[model samples]
Target: MSMSLRRRSGHGARLGAAGLLTFAALAGTGAAHADVAAPRALPAGCSGTSPITCHYAVAPGNYDVTVSLGGAASAGQTEMWVEARRLMLPATRTAAGSVATYSFTVNVRQPEGQPTGQGGTGNPGLNIRFTGSNPQVSAVSVKPAPQPLVAYLAGDSTVCDQPSAPYTGWGQVITTAVRPGAVIANYADSGESSGSFLSNAALFPALLSKIRANDPVFIQLGHNDKQTSASAYRNNLDTMISRVRAKGGVPVLVTPPVRRLFDGNRLTPTALHVNGVGVNLPAEMRAVGTAQRVPVIDLTAKSKALVESLGTSASAQLFLRSSVDGVTDNTHFSQYGATRIGELLLQGIREQRLSLAAYLR
Candidate 1:
C-alpha cells in the first residue's frame, strides 16, 4: 500500500525527495498488510495497520519527527523505529480516546541506515515504522532539523542495529534514553574490528563525511578484535580519533561490553574481553582514551559489575539464550539486555560529562 505527498517550503524546497509526510502518505509495508481505513475513523494518510510504515523522501540530513499515537475507538500500544531497526521509542501504552504525542530527531542517509556488513540491509528514504500489540498512528509530522547534534556509533554486531528483532544492540536503543535535539546514527556492523571499521570505505569514511562541528563519534570494538595486537588496536583508534578531530568532531572511545561468561560467581578473563593474544582489551581502550585525551566509556567495567552482581542465573537474562532467542549466544544482547546496556552507556555519558550527556533523558 502506498500514497504520495506534495513538497512544502524550506526543507522540501531543497533538491531531491525532500518533503513532509502527512497522514496520507503512511502505509503498511510489513508482512501483514494494512486494512484500508474509514475516512472519519483514521487519519487521511494513515491505515489501520499493525505495522504501519511511513516514508518521507528527503535529502540526506537530520529530520525532526513528530508522531501522534493512540486511537479514539480502542486503547493501543506502540513501538517506533526509524531507518533500519534503530528503536526510537520503546513500547508505550496509550488509553482509548487519547493521543500521546512524541518527537525525536533522525539522521537520514543514502544507504538509509547502518549496513550490517552482511548483505541485504537498509531501506530507502526516511522510513518510520510502528509495531506492537496495537499500533495507532493518528498523525505524523516530519521536518528538517536545523543543526541538531548527531552521535555516530562505530563498532561490531553487539553495537550495530541487528536487522532482525529479539536480537538488538545497545546503539539501536540508546536514542530512547536521550532527550530530543540529539540523534544517533549507528554505523556499527557485524564482525567489525577497530582496524576494519577505519579502513572500510563504506563505514568510517562515510561517517567522516557526515561529521558536523562538535559532533560526537562513539567508537566501541574488541568483540571481533580478538587477534589484533595492543599496539595495532591503539593505532587504529588513534587514527580514527585524529581524522574525527580533523573534521571537528569529538571522538569518544568505548570499551566493548562483557560477555555473559561466568566462573563460579566471578566473570572469567575471557568474559572480561581479554583477547586471544592475552591483551586486556578494555584496559587498552582506557589507555588510548587517556593518551588521546578522549572520553572513554568503560562499558566493560560497568557491564562486568552488573553481570557479576546479577550472577550466573540472573545475568543470563542479559544475553541471548537458546530458550529466549532460539540461539544460545553469550556475546550478543537481547532486548532487555540491550536496554540495560544503553542505560549503562547513558550513565557513562553523564559520568564523563560528554556534551551528549546534556541531552540525556
Candidate 2:
C-alpha cells in the first residue's frame, strides 16, 4: 500500500502554562483513586489537539503502561499511540472532571522502536503519544513487563505501522483492541512481498529470532506480491509458517485487504487483489493456510464485503481520499478504516479461537 513514509520527529506543539495548570489540577484531583497515580504537576509536552509525546529512556523490550486519560477543563476525547504510531487506545471520550484509566503493553526497540520497518530513526526509549479533538493526559506509568503474549505482524504496507497521519495500516491500530499482557510487534513494512519479507534481514529474520513458544505470528502480504508467481507466493508463505513452527510459534495467515478500485457496483479483479499474472493472491494464501493447517484471517474477503457494501463514493472514508489528506490513496487506510480493520482482525482471532483472543479488550 505504500513505501516507507517519513518517521515522526520529536517536534510538536506544546501545552501553554495555563493548559498545564489545568492538566495538573485535573490530574492531581484524580490521582487518589486511580491505579496509576497522576503527578502533582504533569511534565511539559502535553498538547491540546496535536499529538503530545512523552518519552522515557528505557531499554528495548516490552513494557506495561498505564495511562490516565482526561484532564481538560471541558470534556475531552483522546487516542494513544506508542512507538511508530501503534494504536494502544482509540478515541476515548471523557466528561468534564472525569478520568479514565487504561493499561496495555508496548514493545519498544531501538532505532525506530517499532518491531520492524526501516525509516526515520526513533529516540532511545519509549515514546507515548496522545492525539484527538481535545487530547489530554492525567498520568502515565511504565514498567518493564516480565512476560506478555507477543503478537508479531508481518506483511506489506497495508498491514504495517504507517509512520504518519491519514495513511494508517491495520497493524498500527490493532493494538487498541488488546489489553495488557499482550503486545503487538509489527515488523510489516511498506512494499514488502511475501518473498521479500522472508528474505529481508530486518524483517522475517529479526522476527524469527524473537519468537517465543506459543507466540502468534500473523502474516499478510500480497499487495506487493502481485507480480510473484502463484507457486512462489504459496511457497514463501509455507516457508514462513514452517519457520515460525520451528521456533515453537503459531503462524496465522491474513489475506491482504482489497484496494478501493470498483467497476460500477462491484470491485474489479485487480482491486480484489488478483496478481498481474492473473492469480488471485488471497486465494493462494488461503490454499497455503489450508495445506499447512494454519488459521487464516480472510481480510481480503472481509474488506471486500465492507468496501462493496459501502460502494465507491461512500467507501472513500475507508481509504485516504484527497478530501481529507490532499491525496487519494486507494490502497492505504485512514484512521477510521484502520480501526475497523483492527476490529475485523479481533473478530477473526475470536473465530479462530486464538489464545490471544482472551486478552482482547
Which candidate ranks first by TM-score, i.e. highest?
1
Q: Candidate 1's error at 271, in angstroms? A: 1.1
Total residue pair clashes for candidate 2: 1
The residue-by-residue lDDT of candidate 1 on 1-361, one tens digit each, is 0011111211111112322121212222111222333222444444548788777777878888877776446667788888768777667666666666667788787665455336354655788888988888877988898889999999888888787877888888777655458888888888888898998888999889989899999999899988999999999999999999999999999999999887899999999989999999899999999988999999999999999999999898879888878998889999879878877787788778999976654
For each candidate, what is the lDDT?
0.77, 0.76
> Candidate 1: lDDT of 79?
82
Cα deviation in Å at residue 302, candidate 1?
0.3
- Where does model 2 exceed 4 Å of error? 1-40, 43-51, 71-74, 113-118
Compared with the true structure, model 1 gives a TM-score of: 0.86
Estimate, for each residue in 1-361, the C-alpha lDDT of model 2 and write its tens digit. Answer: 1101111131212323321111112222222122323323454434444566788888988998888766455666777778887766656666666666666788887656334535666777888888888776777888999889999999888777777787788888767656578888888888888998899888899999999999999998889987899989989998999999999999999998889998899999999889899999999989999889999999989889989999889999988888688898889988878866766777788789998977654
As a whole number from 0 to 100, the lDDT of residue 141 in candidate 2 is 85
